[model samples]
Target: MRILVTGCAGFIGYHLTLKLIENGHNVMGIDNLNDYYDVRLKLDRLKELGIDSDNALHQNKTVASDSFKGFKFVRMSIEDRENLPQLFDHNHFDVVCNLAAQAGVRYSLENPEAYVDSNIVGFLNILECCKNHNIEHLVYASSSSVYGMNKKIPFNTTDSVDHPISLYAASKKSNELMAHTYSHLYGIRTTGLRFFTVYGPWGRPDMAMFLFTEAILNHKPIKVFNHGKLERDFTYIDDIVQGITQIVENKHTAAYNSDNLYHLYNIGNSKSVKLLDFIEAIEDEIGLKASKEMMPMQPGDVEKTWADVSGLERDYNYRPNTPIKSGVKKFVAWYKTYYGNSNE
Candidate 1:
């Protein structure tokens, strides 16, 4: 299988690309390498896959090798219309994993325009390319945030996701709706994975795990939002990669009432952990006490998130198995080694 993995430099993207490459698939990776956090971190992720600084971001940059058996990476944003079409024209990809997006919910409030460009326009461009090229399957990242403020304990795919609280969440929900439209109109098989609070090695700095770890190691006070009452279904990176790989291989072909192929499911750790407990796991892993700064819930933040992955499990036997203790231990170990500080 020849696959195009967008956001290849990102945390989830990095792991997913590696998994695909290891499975004997030729992967063409793409990322804008934007300074959402540190571009250096993103570069380091790519560097791990044998993509160096010199040839990373050049347009049509293709580094082919035996490093990961079969993998090539390009540094380009999906928002670039011309570049996207050109890349699609050059490579005949059977599947496209659209993991790229403007991700943070709080960040969305600060920069809504970025969401529009990356999550909305960029996603549309990917759909267009996939449609034009007649790609077999299109798997894209959606989010649990799309179920914003819903009183539902376990968010489901059939729930009404019409009231997203943040621009980021709204953009992701819009992606699902838009994907369905494209599938209906152009006969593209599209699947949307609503990821829960994903965290692990090479995780995003904007996410809770990274921030709490960084602050705890530095002896700074970690902010406990919503007065430490928030709960999240923190899905580990390995589990996420496995679930996504299964979904990509098992492309959904069920036709909707409109006679189009579309499917959406929650990919998450079924159990939700309170925010304070999650921090405690990190503290235990790093063998440190975190200074606490209890704070009010920020805007567009949900008090709790739980995923009903029953549908995913029933359909594809997808079950996330990494407990918070184990996941946190792995992340802390990776953080220590990667940053040269065992306690960090």
Candidate 2:
């Protein structure tokens, strides 16, 4: 199968692209490489996939990987109306894993336009291309944040996600609606995976795991939001990738109703670990205690997020089993190797 993976430089997208390539699929990856976090990390991820960072200039030029014969990469934004269509028309992609989006929930509060440009307008371009090119499957990245302020114990796909607390979550919700429209009109099969707080090696710098690990190792104070009362269903990257792979390979076609070709599922670890316990895991991994700075929860932040992935388990036999302790240990090891603790 030929696959087009957008945001291939992103934490999840990079891992997903590597997995697809390992399974002998011809994969073309694209990422704008915006400096939302450190662009260096994104470049390093591309480097691991055998793409030369020097050649990854953001000019829409496609760069073939040096190591992987079946892999190619391009530095382009999904919102590029002209080039995106040209790429679609030329390549005839079988599947499009649309992982590209302006990601940070808090950052959305500062720069809402970024969400509009990448999440909404960019997704529209993807749907248009999928519609025009007759793509078989369109699997996109949604977020658990969409279940904002809901009193539900475990966030389910069937639950109402109408009240998103953040712009990032709202953008993801909008993507689901747009995808359903495309599925209904053009017969394109669409699936939206609402990812939980995914953390592992090559994780985003803005995320809690990365931030806590870095600060703790440096003997800096770690900010505990909501006075250490938060909980998250922190899903591991490998498990997330496995679930995506199963979804890609599974040919369970949706029902024949015009509006039935679209589906949504939560991809997350079912266990919601407390914030303090998660921090303890990191501390145990790094052999250090963090200076704590307890603070109130920021705006656009939810107190807790617990994914109900039974829908995913029932449909795809997916189960995320990586415990927070083990996951944090792995992340800490990677961090030490990559960023070399000078304090050691």
Which is the leading candidate under TM-score?
2
Candidate 1: regions farther than 4 A off? 251-260
- Worst lDDT window (10 residues) for model 1? 251-260
TM-score of predicted structure 1: 0.96
lDDT of 1 by residue, 1-344 (tens): 99999999999999999999888888999998999899889988988898877788676677764367588888888999999999999999999999999989999989999999999999999999998999988999999999998998888888989999999999999999999999889999888999999999999998999999988887889989989989999999999999989877764523222344788989999988999999999988788999999999899999989999997887777878999999999998888788887552
| Backbone clash total, candidate 1 | 0
Q: List the pairs of residues colliding in candidate 2.
A: none
lDDT of candidate 1 at residue 132, scale 0 to 100: 92
Clashes of each: 0, 0
The TM-scores, one per candidate, come to 0.96, 0.97
